[model samples]
Target: MEQPNSPEAAADRVLDAALMHVAFDGWTDATFRAAVLDSGVDAALAKALFPRGGLDLAIAYHRRGDTLMREALAKTDLSSMRFRDRVAHAVRLRIEAVEDREAVRRGTTLFALPLHAAEGARLIWGTADAIWDALGDASRDLNWYTKRATLSGVYSSTVLYWLGDDSLGHQATWDFLDRRIEDVMRFEKVKAQLRENPLSKAILSGPLKFMENIRKPVVPDDLPGRVMDRFRPKS
Candidate 1:
């Protein structure tokens, strides 16, 4: 038997309907209204499902891609790959999950508004967190924040480069991704070096001590930022 209707089912229907109109309407209220009509989902239910309408639809779309990436990551074998290679591959997988560039372009425009920029940033940070969690990151300290923060920068930049890329098979975007990842690696290397150097360590002791006290945020499993809570502090 088929499953009953639910909020998730309703959201998915509206999102699927919205995608066909996104290229035309740009994820706006017009698109949302069209989706509500096209999807045949109840207006009140759809409104409850997506209180913010098109913006929430864009969020749902982004999250769907994230879910697909996680599913892909779980099936792939990464044991033989180097750590950086795994990170790069994860990023590639995340970007590759998108089926419609126009939809994302529309979403980018929607999220670029001053009112929505912070929400957009939070979504990117969430993607970075999901990538790190899927890759088995064990850090429970300040490195947690730094890793997600850096990856968010890398992912966002790669995405912008990808949006404009027209070369064969998007090889240019992959090359750009590798260079960005390499930049992150070099930055991490320098940070490690500073931590290991006695002189720099001595000079930074006060700041380092303060940093040591900064721990990762803990969120419930059902929350959007749950990835940050996957690892408890080591005993």
Candidate 2:
């Protein structure tokens, strides 16, 4: 329900225009300028919308993919699927949401730079968080971090494999994903066994006590501090 000239709308316009140049320019300053010109948003306004230029646009594009994945997850019937299958479905939806492989390829290159590495990790974490949130994760403690952290590893590896996979229907990538998820399931099973064993649990009591205090992160919803919201990864 945003107005036509709202900042969000303008940002979307610039992003739409920038996508055309990302594959060729790899989300550089040149592409940012071209997008501003192509989007017909004032140069100053475009700058205000994306102060970091192409990097911000790339972040926006990645979040847009996450949003698309969330929407797809909402519409799909996942009730009949097993827990692991649902996780795989969500990851596949996230990857399949990509409109341009080359754009993501370029993004991978841009974010791989040491200067932008942290932002890249945040985006991946954001995606993993979105997948878990969409699937009705109720963990409020350390499990919240553990679930996303574990899935982040699975999702990142799967993406790398997917980019290189040219198999029919990317069956190879899906197979790789299943294997990775199975590995995680095995690890989780081991953790459960350790917790169930009295001796092992006693030995790890100190660390377990520390972990008990860890909780899910929360962003304040104060309206006056909304300007900083742009920097946050959308859920």
Candidate 3:
């Protein structure tokens, strides 16, 4: 009897084929194509199975890291942790997760996403930027130092710069992050002092007034009502 074509079967075939390609030939677009050929799966089916190609697989890897981070963060009291400690914890968790996932992928024929050196730098930097953005206002505090957007950006930039570093110990990136954090803390102290001064308060009032003037107009626009009407089902 012939086997039925189910979504699960199709998914398995794609994953199995992807693993095979990764194991025999390092992960690459050409390797992906070869996997399809080896599996005898049609091009259209393969495309449908993995629409975003290697990017989709890479994103899956990122999601796994995110899940681990979220779970870890949930158990910790962010309010009590020092900024550097928080950033270190998050980084360690992500690195460990990726290392574990890479090991699992290695055991299979599945090829990991083939990221060139530049592409890898971009991914790491982008991830740091994303974390900075997520931390938001909490990052501005000196106690929350390393997780600050500016500090994170520095860390990311250092990582990118270190990608090509051929020197012993790779100490440049670590030094950069440390110095950047210190500089940010110093600047924050200066800003805090200014915030406490009467002259700075007067100067800040002008910006506040400007923001007040930029408020949105309270026009009685009914565009939302029209949009809702269109979505409403007919009686």
Candidate 4:
């Protein structure tokens, strides 16, 4: 039965329907349209609720999830946390958020890929690798947005792969994630090394000096001489 329509209620219905459609039919334009129709809402309202359609809704969901994760991250002193712990926390938060949403739709216990098992370990590692690449240099402004986008892309791809992976014990997907994490970790190490290198320091420092020079007004050669003359000790 269709829910009674308040603006908020109507929007919720659309989102609920859309998620169900994606779960069953996969995320596609046609599926989204079908979802809207199934939800028993006016098409105009659905279109307004999702301006770019299902893809937009999907992206919005990811963005909302990222926002939630970032809020949690902001409250923590990441410097105090070990790197692996931080990575694990971040990954787990994201996975749980997705699983919770899935539970709302499907009402089942979604299992975490076991971290100790070979396949499960691989999945965790691969996701971590992609996350590191997305994060880049740990600069709050640059790395945060980049990593969020990268994580979203990796997560979506991972979900798709998982759906299709029916191998014994679902080991194939886990193995794939493991390899992915290793590659990302290797790249992150290289990035960390480059940042720490003397040459990189010199290069970054050079730009700062150049900016300082540009900010100050260029003085005429006579200006220094005049200033010196004013300060000259009596002969």
Candidate 5:
């Protein structure tokens, strides 16, 4: 049964409780129960709001970051910046919006478990997809997948780095992130150059030609819907 509050409101209420306990309890069943007690919602209501327990909260946590990132990105003036700068800022905004560093730290630990790793990857991919969409990327082919895959590495590594960073204002972690972005930029430049090279073109034109033989790639825009479907209860 649905709760009296709208889905969004109920989710927010549950999330409030979850954020309070996740940092210490690590998104376990114990944390779920604690969040339920803290939320003052009927036990069944809490279950309905978060059928997957802590994993749902973790997803909500990721989504909250995405929301925060989009809002923050909107306020920043990025029109004058380079493409890479915009992308980097988009990623940094997501991290900086975090109110509690340990929530992320605990989330990292939770996702690191073998059983949770796939779900973690899915969350990371969603974050990457959100960031790219925010950046106004128009590429619909190979670039779409490659861009998100690369950003996931950058975002994940930066989050892990930020977890341990003790510098004032996390200045050191930002410095590390800058270097990583530069690395990606350099790699992208190489790929662009390779794509333009005559030898590469010749290779693609050869008898066993490459580009034409490969099937077109498709990145479904409904990934989040598909992901949620996996957790939805069957009728």
Candidate 6:
């Protein structure tokens, strides 16, 4: 529903042009100029629309996908699904939001640059946070941080997997996504179990030395044998 010529609409036009060029130029300032030129908008408008040039254009591209996912999610009633299923739907919808394979490939190649790798991470973090928010997550503390962290791993892996998928309908990628979600579930279960165990309480409260071998049995195999032999009569 973009108006014919608003600032926001103009930015969209520039961004649309940028995507067309990214597959060819890999999100460079060259791509930015070309997009502005191709859009027939004033070149200065690129600075106003994306001050950081190509990097900002890349972020905006991601934001457009996030917006599409959010809009589609609004139409669904996720209340009936389990939280994991809801999470699955949310991620799948986000992936579906991206229709341009070349655009995604170029974005990945652009972000792989050492300077922009951090930027790429921030981009992934943004999408994770967006997906969680779109799913109506309401946690407001450490849980919020942990939730986003976990989903960040899930979303990143799925996106990478999706990039190489050649299956009809990308069914293989969806399977990979399901497995990653299951990994999260199993990890949470492990964390819960550890919290319920008294040994974990000791590990948290005990001396730092205790933590070094927390995964091992409480009694050292060699220590127990040596102690028992010492207790026997010295012969």
The digit string of per-residue lDDT tens for model 6 on 106-126 reads 888888899889988888888
Off by over 4 Å in 3: 1-28, 34-46, 72-80, 100-152, 161-176, 208-235
- Please give, for residues 17-75, the per-residue lDDT of candidate 5 as tens digits: 88888767887778888888887777887888789898888878878888889889988
lDDT of 6 at 143: 62
TM-score of each: 0.92, 0.93, 0.48, 0.48, 0.85, 0.83
- Model 2 misplaced stretches (Cα beyond 4 Å): 226-235
Task: Judging by lDDT against the true structure, name the best candidate.
Answer: 2
Better of 3 and 6 by lDDT: 6
Error of 3 at 163 (Å): 4.1
Q: Give the TM-score of candidate 6.
A: 0.83
lDDT of 3 by residue, 171-235 (tens): 65456556766676778788789879999989898775655444322345357666566566753
Least well predicted 10-residue stretch by lDDT in candidate 4: 104-113
- Model 2, position 199, has a per-residue lDDT of 100
Off by over 4 Å in 5: 1-4, 205-235
Candidate 5: TM-score?
0.85
User: Tens digit of lDDT per residue, candidate 2, span 42-107?
Assistant: 999999989999899999999999999999999999989999999999999999999888888888
Native-to-model Cα distance after best TM-score fit, residue 187 in candidate 2, in Å = 0.6
- Order the candidates by lDDT, highest first — what do you get? 2, 1, 5, 6, 4, 3
Clashing pairs in 4: 122-177, 122-178, 125-181, 126-177, 126-181, 134-147
TM-score of 1: 0.92
Better candidate number, 3 or 5, judged by lDDT: 5
Candidate 3 least-lDDT 10 residues: 103-112
TM-score result, candidate 4: 0.48
Q: Global lDDT of each model?
A: 0.92, 0.94, 0.53, 0.55, 0.84, 0.84
Q: Candidate 4: lDDT of 131?
A: 48
